[model samples]
Target: MTTDTIITARGLTKTFTVRKAVVEAVTDLDLDVQRGELVAFLGPNGAGKSTSLRMLTTLLPPTSGTATVVGHDIARDPAGVRRRIGYIGQGTSAGHNQRVRDELLSQGAFYGMGRRAAATRADELLESLDLAPLATRKVLGLSGGQKRRLDIALGLIHSPELLFLDEPSTGLDPQSRANLWQHILDLRREHGTTIFVTTHFLEEADLFAERVLVMDHGRMIADDTAGNLKTTLAGDVITLGFASEADARAAAARAGGTAAGSSLSLTVDHGELVLPRLLRELDSVTSATLRQPTLDDVFLALTGRSLREDAATSKEEINA
Candidate 1:
């Protein structure tokens, strides 16, 4: 591992046996994350997103393979790894009865910070995360957004070099999600902290992460920038509608597009550049629309299923 590499893993695998059947939760997972990079790890449910995180954070042991986190071997020096990294999981970590500031201080103490330093750090986090107003408030009294912020504060109480967040904004409303993300961005900008996050919100990953890693069926499937992934895998989409199905079919044949009823859809390298040429070449185009491909479209192209649909279905299954 290089000096600037904050995380490195090779052939990491995790397996479980249920009903006398072996199930691989993560397999041959190789990854490297450089310092100060915000990486988004994405996949549908049952895709090993959480499993990979658990292994790297030393919360769960990998069935095979090796990983080094924050310059410490995860399996051989879990305490060293844990001390240098902070993890905020999907669930809340604060105690219901403890005051918010108190919880932060407690976490610092748990990491062996001196009383004065812990108090100072706790106050700093309360101000930075906008939790100062709720410092004396009970954990259960804060709203979902406030509680999530407090969770982040607790994670950062020890000033770790790397932070791992698993679905940090899962249940927030749109406004709250936006607020939380702004704080996260500010942290990365100000602290130069490396962030490895897994989120169900596709737009968040596309908008914020420098690099995106896609996993499915316990394996790494894709790794690239969001724009590159969309461009390379899904491409831009051009839809042209005709008055008659025959006209659409003719246009489809001429442009190598797909026709459904009276509409022809074509995926191209650049829709804006191709649309004008296509219009000049084909006649009887009643309507035309060009759109850039989204991360969901990339997911559809890769897994043969929509990530949004899969996430919804998984949530329903869990609730059932």
Candidate 2:
């Protein structure tokens, strides 16, 4: 690994025996994340996203292969890896009864921080995450968004170089999600922390992440910028509505597009340039609609299924 590489993995695999049947949770995953990059890991449920993270974070050992996190070999020196990285899991990590500031202080103590240092760090996080007003509030009394912010504070108690977040904003409302992300962006901007996160919200990844890694069926399939993936894999979609089904079919034949009912749809690299030409060439088009591709479109093109459908399904299937 290079000096600037925060994480490096090759042939990382994980397996489990479920009712006497072997299930591959993750397979031959190879990845490299540089320092100060915000990477979003995307996958359908039961697609091994969580399992891969568990192995990399040293919560679970890889069945085979090797990885280094924060300059420490995960298999040979788990303690070293754990000491340098922060992990905020799907579930809340704070105790319900403990006060927020005390919870953070306790987390610092767990990381071997002295009492005075832990207190100082806790105060800093409380202010940075906007949790200072609620520092003495009981954990259970805070709202869902407040709890998530506290979770982030606990993860950063040791000021680790890298942070791994698993569905950090899954259950928050739209406004709360936006608030949480703003704090995350500020953290990265202020501290230059490398963030590797898995999120169900595709828009969050598209808007904030520097790179996106897509996984399916226990294997890494695609990795690139969200813009590049949408442009190359999904492209722009143009829908032309005709006066009749026959007119639609004729237009499809002339334009090399697909015809369904009274509509002709075409996928092109640049819809703005192609749509006007197609409209001038075809006289039967009664209406035209040009749509830009989203990250969901990229997922559908890659997997032959919509990610929204997969995301709506029960998350319990991928608990491993």
Q: Rate the local accuracy (lDDT) of all candidates.
A: 0.90, 0.92
Measured against the true structure, the TM-scores of the candidates, in listed sequence, are: 0.93, 0.92
Residues 59-166 of candidate 2 have per-residue lDDT tens digits of 999999999999999999999999999999989889999999989988999999999999999999999888999999999999999999999999999998899999
lDDT for model 1: 0.90
Where's the lowest-lDDT run of ten residues in candidate 2? Answer: 311-320
Assess the local accuracy of residue 10 in candidate 1 as a C-alpha lDDT between 0 and 100.
98
Q: In angstroms, how far off is 216's CA in candidate 1?
A: 1.2
**Cα deviation of 3, candidate 1, in Å:** 7.8
**What TM-score does candidate 2 get on C-alpha atoms?**
0.92
Model 2 / residue 40 / CA error / Å: 0.9
lDDT of 2: 0.92
Give the Å shift of residue 195 in candidate 2. 0.6
Q: What is the lDDT, from 0 to 100, of the residue 224 in candidate 2?
A: 99
